[model samples]
Target chain A: MTALEYIRCIGESWPTTKERAYFEALALKEHGRLSPEHVPEVYHFDRTMSLIAMRYLEPPHIILRKGLIAGIEYPLLAQDMAEYMAKTLFFTSLLFRSTTEHKRDVAEFCGNVALIKHTGQVVFSDPYRVSQYNHWTSPYLDQDAEAVRKDNLLKLEVAELKSKFYERAQALIHADLHTGSVMVTPESTQVIDPEFAFYGPMGFDVGAFLGNLILAFFAQDGHADQVNDRKTYKEWILKTIEETWNLFHSKFIALWDEHRNGSGEAYLPEIYNNADVQLLLQKKYMTDLFHDALGFGAAKMIRRIVGVAHVEDLESITDVSKRATCERRALDLAKMLLKERRKFQGIAEIVAVIRQF
Target chain B: MTALEYIRCIGESWPTTKERAYFEALALKEHGRLSPEHVPEVYHFDRTMSLIAMRYLEPPHIILRKGLIAGIEYPLLAQDMAEYMAKTLFFTSLLFRSTTEHKRDVAEFCGNVALIKHTGQVVFSDPYRVSQYNHWTSPYLDQDAEAVRKDNLLKLEVAELKSKFYERAQALIHADLHTGSVMVTPESTQVIDPEFAFYGPMGFDVGAFLGNLILAFFAQDGHADQVNDRKTYKEWILKTIEETWNLFHSKFIALWDEHRNGSGEAYLPEIYNNADVQLLLQKKYMTDLFHDALGFGAAKMIRRIVGVAHVEDLESITDVSKRATCERRALDLAKMLLKERRKFQGIAEIVAVIRQF
Candidate 1:
């Protein structure tokens, strides 16, 4: 569906039957399963608008935002997230492995992914010419505004990253998989609000999740007064990052080992040979993704500070010195995201270092 | 007329009526007299061929080549050539000094001047490519046929120099005043073959003359023995260069002082008193012309050696060392042309130094 149509459908309970159909076909091809319960049912209200209704999965679950606020740290979270992303984005997709003709077809399809294009346009294009959004604001910022905005944009651009991560096939991804989008607990995790879903670099989803947690940790300066408590909170942020990466890596490897159709003679024996080769290839792909993640994370951080809907993290700090300090730290982290992207082996390492700063 | 028609006209006659008419108008503006005898007449015999007819002023008025062969030399030759060029190109015609509208008309008239484009089609075009000249039949050339042919093609692109030289309206120049086109005597020098005459930069005319002289000097080794008359021959070449520039500068300044129409207003008071600003402006113009002459001269020299048209001076040197030495010296002169172009204060100084090199 077109961007305007999608937005109208979301706001006015219009039907999105055609959009759901397209996603279902794609999901079946990529995931080998069509989760009807997870996808929306669409009904046309008018030629230009549609209503989308879905089975909203509730918790024993918590959105990523609530989890961040509640300090609900998960084990090996960063590793698990990275592994899920690498497998989903690279090995399983036809984009990196397909014939030229098939790759072109997929590229064309992904190019028109409306949600991705729409969000980018809304964020980057002039608001006077484009339909203004609540999040739209001038990127030309003052000293404080400039600092935060630049930090975010730098994270998104990843100017210093050694390798590009956009060569892989972009599937229909839940692009905004931040705290508010994810509903999770200790044993079970549920993702909701797929309205912002689109085909994009998988690093985007990973970056959003990690970026919001970093934001919350910095916001603690205004929220908590005890110096000792602040140090503990900071440690928790580092632990959460390390645990996320470990969990994501273990889970992804297990999935690949159990489900892969390795006939021991399938195509590309050279790539599939031994554990060392596999690890090397995986490491290269992970490193590239880390750079892209840093760039996207910076973009999100900057937008929240100078964008129209300012975040409460720095705004809540009331005192200019305290607020500036929080912002300077966030900017520093964002800069590090771009400058040290290649050095980061896993999400845990990056998160661990960022929280300490 | 188109390029084809122009080439056809030059190939068929001694004096081109059209060429004469064009130059006569220029002469009338400068000398306040129209001497038809001084210009060639142009005529079209067919769509593909035409001819020129004119008084072939002969004997004591020998072409520059005959004098070179006889080991005779002229003093201040470069200066004489530069004045002739400056007078013809800048002063005599509306070619360089014309308004935009007038310039457009003149440019259209001279559109067929590019020799390379016309030769390219005749030499390399499909269906009727000329193969007779493809073989390395030149007993004098040490290089293979393909290398020589490629070098020749490169030299042809030097037509680009026209654009650079044409921007400054410094003189009414006889655009092709090489040795073959001029007839000279001790008392007077009459520039013949006005077919290539156009409103162009003063340096083009100056460069063409100096460049041809350099070519002639280099070709002397093939025409004469280095052991028998090398020292005396070299001295003559050097003197010719020094004398050429001196005469050209003296004549140019004389003309400016006698006829310049400035009303005692200074354009460059810092360089000269306000009362003689026009003379200073003229001097500045001559300096610029010298710089351009140097650049074009260098390009012309380099193109002939590494490019096409192997000079006879090096051709006589059977030993590669001697030939390469001559080539190296020529190149050094060419480089000096480029490097010291801006520092040149007068024609005599440049000519004198270049002769030593």
Candidate 2:
């Protein structure tokens, strides 16, 4: 006999709750065509009750963050994650879809504004202002939090990022792409809980994944004890961040080249046909994307340290002083990344900088 | 007794025809709050018939292009036009409205995509590619038109402009703001026929007005007679172009300052309160806007010369060779503006460049 589970929301956030259910169904249906291996199959959905019944990621499968906290290394984690992000993001982007298809889907997803508004408040707005929702490792990092609230240059960069998040619908994005949303085993990696999906800047997705990995890396020091120094695992995390971005960039460009003459409207082959101009267009596009990813990734990191939500990676550490030290290092790197993201040209440079901190 | 005018459409472009009816009503209703003197009051609208009945700008009122062709100058032209552009654009921008109001209007305008598509084709696509709709002066502009079609650098720039036209929803714009769209007299400047109105980049509206003014300046030599060499009229036109942009910039900043503490969502007062950061934000914003206006204006000029639509300022000239010479000068200047708009820092520089040509 087989067992089935149906999930339902119990509170006032039902509109977004229902929307997430709808989007997950839509995404799973579409992503099924690209690569079905990483998405949970939808069995049934009830829109009125905000209920969903689907495949359960049982037993061996565990949240990636939990696995990371336990110092367990999934060797295939980087490759599987890179493939999932590339296939899901690229397939849903204008780089692959027609304008008609793209706009129609964009309009549909704009109804997910309830969730977007929540993200806008927590990730961009609340951290910079005195808000009831905001918290941190109090007393120990009190001055650091106040400094974040008063940093004019950092706020200026964040304003630009917030505008992009609100206005620039460059692609359909899984707005919350953190490690907590992934379930992993030694042989497989599956992305789950994408209720925050909508048409937004693709950099938001890339940044979330990389930013969460940084959080995990910083938390390693807090997790270290006499038995395992955790130095090697930290190196592995750095390598994973470097490899994921490089692989995703190459894969995205490969898709662009493969579909150069396809239905994508942004760069028409007839106009951008010559080798020289095509190369120029690609370089400019990727450079801008890289900067956006860094800026947004830094924003995500800052919000985790001082904003409404605290990550489990840092919260799991028992000692307050040790946690605060790890968090301050992350905060310092994040500030540098947000203000000086444009100066960075590549992911390897970012990895090198991460090691410096 | 008062008379009434009713317009009815008979064909497939009825959606745009109807949208014009809808927007004129919305604009007039809102514009009434700002300045009822410039925009005509809508009397009646019938959606099924795709019709509008509105106030008529009575005699002595003539299309501004005709007045320019006759070498007649209105002293209040610069002030009146600048006021019109500032009031309409600033009031409709996110600088003045709340996000809820802005998004509602933006979504409503997105339904007017048919007209937007027409603009995308005529203004951006046709000139860059060989299309049946494209027409220019035979023999005189045959080579010039061919050069435009083959100019890779020009097309590349056009592609960027096209993307902005299709993507950036910075403000509500009169997408066809040109001299021909204005009714003028010695005392009054009235804007009419905003049938292509939609939520788009504000620079498009600013550029259209200035680009048409530039076209009128180039056509002065063709209108030159033994009785009137038009040397003084050319200087007046140049002064008007320079004054209009400078005045518009000042007035826009004034509005931003006035409403800095208002519901505007782009730069919140809480974050952008300091003088140094405020100055930086304003300078960066206006500079980008200036470049966008110049680029869009140049694209408008190039289209009028080489694309499906030809401006009356150049077309009214009887001699083909004379018309061709005037057009080639305007085209040369426009191509420069489109390619090097960012290099220009102020309005005086643009006026100086115009004088050089």
The best candidate by TM-score is: 2
Cα lDDT tens digits, model 2, B21-40, are 66656665566456567777
lDDT of 1 by residue, B38-90 (tens): 33223222322233333345457677666665666665344555555545543
CAPRI-style grade of the A/B interface in model 1: incorrect
Model 2 per-residue lDDT at A351 = 92
- lDDT tens digits, residue span A152-271, model 1: 333223311111112122344556556565555565444455544533456676677677767877866755665335667667776665565566556545654554444311112322
- What candidate 1 gets wrong by more than 4 Å, as runs, is A1-9, A13-53, A73-87, A90-92, A95-112, A122-141, A147-171, A225-231, A253-267, A270-276, A308-324, A346-349, B1-357
Give candidate 1's fnat, 2 decimals: 0.00
**Recovered native contacts, candidate 2:** 0.17
Interface RMSD of 2: 2.2
DockQ of each: 0.01, 0.42
List candidate 2 stretches off by more than 4 Å: A1-35, B1-35
